[model samples]
Every structure is written in C-alpha cells, then in structure tokens.
Target: MAPISIRNNPDRLRYEVLDGDLAIGQAAYVDDGEGRRIFYHTVIDEDYGGQGLAGRLAAQALDETVAAGLMIVPVCPYIKNYLGKHTQYADNIQKPTPALLTVLNNALARRTRR
Candidate 1:
C-alpha cells in the first residue's frame, strides 16, 4: 500500500490527500477573509474508496484550521456530517451564512474563469 499524506494547497484553495506522490483526494474550501474557512466540497478518487481518506482529510484540515486560529464553516455535507459526530471542533465551527456562501461562490467562479 502507498503511504498517505495530507497537505493544504492554499494556492488552489484546497487540501489535497496524496498516496505517495499521487493526489487521491481533495477537500475544497475558501477563506472568508474573516478568520473562517468555508469548506464546500470533498472527494476521493473511486479507486481509493473505502480507505477512510475522506475522514483523514477532514480531520487534518479541521485540525490545521483550528491551529491557525481560524473557524470552520462546513458547507459541504460531508464536512457538516463529520462535524456532527466529532465534538472536538464544535467550538471552532461557524454555521454557514449567506455572506460566506457568496464568498465561496465568488472564489469558485474566479477559479473557473482562470
């Protein structure tokens, strides 16, 4: 089995999960520019399914976001559901707001334009 690693790729506004040197999954988010990371989506390649990579990715991303003194805004259903079962991040979670959704939407639109 290949080793797994997770990293924040701020340039791309996402956290990438790697199997050795290959990217196998990603959790996408946008910084609200106000101490919040609005997570919008997460996915693992079908080939790598059933390995718990999504959980690992969520844990690492949420951990790092808290460590950085940022709040988590889980717009993605997976992330929201993960938080429902994990209380550690309860204090750091911010419910999604319309303004935050705008932030995420604008960021995604900009990315698509590029």
Candidate 2:
C-alpha cells in the first residue's frame, strides 16, 4: 500500500494529500482575514476515491485550523458533512455571514452545474 501524507499549501488555498510524489486529493479553502477559514471544496482523484483520502484531508485541515487559532466556516458540503461525523472539531466552527454564505452557495452551485 502506498503511504499518504498531508500538507497545507496556503499559497494555493488548499491542503493536499500526497501519495509519495503524486497528489491524489485536496481540500480547498479561503482565509477570510478575520481569523477564519472558509473551506470550499474537497476532492479526490477518481482512482483514489474509495481509500479514505478525504477523511484524512479533512482531519488534517481542521486540526491545523484549530492549531492556528482560527475558526472554520465550512462552506463546502463535504467539510460540513465531515464535521458532522467528527464533531470533535465543532468548537472551531463559526456561522458564516450572509454575504459569505451567498458566495459559498454560488460556488457549490457552479460546481454542481459543471
């Protein structure tokens, strides 16, 4: 089995899951500059989808968010759902503002249409 490693790539607004030298998944986010991060997308390569990469990605990302003393605005459904199951990360979650909610909804809709 290939070993997977997780790393934050803030320059690209995402946390990546690396399988050796290959990137197999990512969870994308935007820093709101108000000490909060809005997670917007979580994706795994189709070939890598069933291997629990998304869970690993979510865990690392949320754990780092807490470590950074930042709150989470889970704009992405995958993240919202992940947090639901985990709950341990609940203390860091923040409700999004109306404007931010609109933006996130639009993003999700756009992806669904694609």
Candidate 3:
C-alpha cells in the first residue's frame, strides 16, 4: 500500500489527502482571521471511502490547525463526529459564534460541486 500524505492547501482552504500522487480526499475549513478556524467538511472520494482515510484526514487537519496555533470550530458533521471520538483534541475545540456559523454555512454552500 502506498503511504498517505496530507497537507494544507491554503489557497483552496483545504487539507488535501494524497495517496502516492493521487488526490483521494480533503478536509475543508475557513479561517476566521481571529486565530480560529471553522472546519466544515471532510470528504473522501467514494472509491477511497471505507478505508479510514477520512479519520486520517480529520486528525491531520486538526493537527495542522493546532500546530499553527489556531483553535478549532467544528461546523462539519464529519469533523464534529471525529472530535467526539477523539478527546485528545478537545483542548483546541471551541463553540462557534453566530457570525462564524454564518460564514461556515456559506462556505459549505459554495462547495456544492464537491
């Protein structure tokens, strides 16, 4: 099996999951510019689904966000779900403000193509 790689794609506001040069999944987020990031989506191609990549994506996304000294506002069900099962990242989690919720929802709406 090829090793999986994940990294932030700032221009796209996503943490891209790569499998040996193949783009397999992504964890999407929006930065609030106030030292917090609102993560709203975690998706893997159906072909890649069921392989636990989504969990890896969530971990790496949260890990990178923490490394950047930012907090997390989980607006995505997938991410929220992931965090629920991983208490270690609880320190970085925060409740989203109404304004942040609006921004998160709109960013999610824009990703309909995904």
Candidate 4:
C-alpha cells in the first residue's frame, strides 16, 4: 500500500488526497473570495473506498479552512453529512445562504463548461 497524504491545491480550488503520487480522492471547494469556502463536491476513487480516506480528507480540509479564518460552507452531501456529526467545526460552519448557493452553482457551471 502507498503512503497517503492530503494537501490544499488552491489553483484547482480543492483539497486532494494522494496515495504516494497518485491522487485517490478530493474534496472540491470554491472560495467565494469574501470569507467563505463552499465545499461542493467530494469523492474517493472506488478502489480506495472503505478506508476512511473521505473522512480524513474532510477533517483536514475543514481544519485548514478554520485555521485560515474562513467560514465553512458544506454544500456537498458527504461534507454536509460529515459536518452534522462532527461538531468541532460547528463554530466555523456557515449555513448556506441563497447568495452562497448561487456562488457555488455558478462556479460549478463554469467548471462544467471548461
């Protein structure tokens, strides 16, 4: 098995989990550039599933976002469900507002077009 690690890839606007040099999972987000990062998607490769990589990814991503003084806006079902059980980040979580939803939708649309 390869060693696993996670890191923020700002250029791609996501937190990626790598097994050695191969990326196996990602928690994608969009920084609204106004104090919040909207996590819109998360996925772990099927081959890498059942290993808790998603939980680890979400934990580190949320940790870094809080450390950076940004609000957490979990729009992805996995992330949203994770947040419901993990209260450590409750203080940093911001309920999704209408405007924030729009921001996320627009960003996702651009990604689809590209």
Candidate maximizing TM-score = 1
lDDT of 4 by residue, 1-114 (tens): 789999999989989999988888999999999999999899999999999999999999999999999999988999999999999888999999999999998988998999
* True-structure Cα RMSD, model 3: 2.8
Any runs in candidate 1 off by more than 4 Å, and if so which? none
Candidates arranged by TM-score, highest first: 1, 4, 3, 2
Residue 69 in model 3: lDDT: 97
Q: Per-residue CA lDDT of candidate 2, range 26-106, in tens?
A: 999877667888898899999887878898899999999999999999878999999899888888999778977776666
What TM-score against the true fold does each predicted structure earn? 0.96, 0.84, 0.85, 0.94
Model 3 worst lDDT run, 10 consecutive residues: 105-114
lDDT of 3 by residue, 46-84 (tens): 987788889888988898899999999998899988899
Task: Note the Cα lDDT for every prediction shown.
Answer: 0.94, 0.86, 0.87, 0.94
Question: For candidate 4, what is the TM-score?
Answer: 0.94
- Model 1: weakest 10-residue lDDT segment is 96-105
Number of the candidate with higher TM-score, 2 or 4: 4
Model 1, 14-107: lDDT tens digits are 9999988888899999998889999999999999999898999999999999999999999999999999999999999999988888888898
